[model samples]
Target: MLSPMQLSKKIQGNDSSQRINYLYQISKKVVEKNPVLSAYYGNLAVSVAKKNVLKIHPDIKRQLCKKCRCMLIDKKSAKVKIKNKKKTKYIQVTCNTCKMTKYFPANKGNNHRLWLENPEAIVEIVN
Candidate 1:
């Protein structure tokens, strides 16, 4: 088995795909036990990807808090709210750990694309 330093070096030297995957796994595994550590790992992952000029996957990126870099799990680590103003709708995500809020447009056109609206887009992962 590799030592912690060697393991981290191996992860850092990997290609973008593998590195991001490792980061995601690490964040997910630690978020429940220690959110601060998870956030640190998440920030490290984002910085590494940015430094390498790689694209962080949208699915993974969306799950992380923009301000605290913490994993956002609704009712667990974050609070999610949907708001409507005038003719526009937006979803607000608040990071419970840091009290930071992020917003995302809920409608783009005639159709709404909120994750709950589409059945196919929702998948229950048994892991």
Candidate 2:
């Protein structure tokens, strides 16, 4: 049987998205054991996407700390809170490792949704 790393390498061949996803998975798995290594892998994933001009998945992008390139796990590596200001409510995520904060608008009245979440965003489905 091929080792996990070798399998990942084989699966990632010629596909930047697959490679980024693999790196993100590796980073998430290694976060508890070695944070620095996790950050390194996360950075690698981001760099790969940038180099290939590919967009990272929204869910993966939101979970990564922009400044430190670390995976932000709620209540462990990050803090999550909701805040209201100027009639706008938003969810705030603060990365404990680098003290970085990100905000996402959460106005119920507006019914805001990411473009990817919309049904119309799907043009084709691959089997």
Candidate number with greatest lDDT: 2
Per candidate, the number of residue pairs that clash is: 0, 0
Model 2 alpha-carbon drift over 4 Å, by segment:
1-8, 11-14, 107-127
Clashes of 1: 0
TM-score of each: 0.72, 0.72
lDDT of 2 by residue, 1-127 (tens): 3476675665466387877777777676677677787788889889999999998877778778889988877766778776888888887888877899988877586443332133332222221
Model 2, 12: alpha-carbon shift in Å?
Answer: 4.9
Task: Estimate the overall C-alpha local distance difference test score of candidate 1.
Answer: 0.71
Q: After superposition, how far is residue 101 of candidate 1 from its true place, in Å?
A: 0.2
| Model 1: per-residue Cα lDDT over 1-127, one tens digit each | 4456875886777786667667766665677778898798789879888988987776677778998898776667778887897777877888878999988877566343334223231222212
